[model samples]
Target: MSTDDPWRPRLAARARLKFDPVAKQELILFPEAALALNETGAAIVRLCEGARSIDQIVDLLSKNYANADRDALMREVMDFLDTIRVRGLLQ
Candidate 1:
């Protein structure tokens, strides 16, 4: 996590994730809402389902998108995560 990047725990931390292998997609359903995720988002959601921190997510993304600059890559990943969170895609 960067100094400028805010980290907020999921509002409903007890929420769980479900993956639909047949659809090659993932869904994060909270008590109030749910979100359907694509492959990349699903990967991130998978990483986040464990106890790994944001830095770990950034590292994973960096290794996956090797051509990207470290800081910029992390920023983009953080931005995507934030967007999903706001859209109720993350628990």
Candidate 2:
């Protein structure tokens, strides 16, 4: 993906994520401490289940939040993905 592509995430096959039942949250745990996700974050986490691409995530968000601006929503989703990935939340 080009640098201008808003939905590009560092693609990797080994990336894994899990939900903590006791905490009622999702966690992305690598070697260091776990990164906890809230409900909205958990929804985004669930969508990246080694299946959908970042563009699909943006489209899904657009469909769900129809009243929101598509570009803005896409940008927000991309930013969130970047934040989570940088925090060791994604593979």
Candidate number of the best TM-score:
2
Q: Estimate each model's TM-score.
A: 0.63, 0.65
> In the order shown, what is each candidate's alpha-carbon RMSD?
3.4, 3.4
Q: In candidate 2, which residue pairs get closer than 3 Å at backbone N, Cα or C atoms, i.e. clash?
A: none
Per residue, candidate 2 scores C-alpha lDDT tens digits across 62-82 of: 787789897877677777888
Off by over 4 Å in 2: 1-15, 49-51, 88-91
TM-score of 1: 0.63
* lDDT of candidate 1 at residue 45, scale 0 to 100: 72
- For 3-88, candidate 1 gives per-residue lDDT tens digits of 34445334246456788677767877777766777777666777765455677777887788788798886676677777877766
Q: What's the lDDT for all of these models?
A: 0.67, 0.67
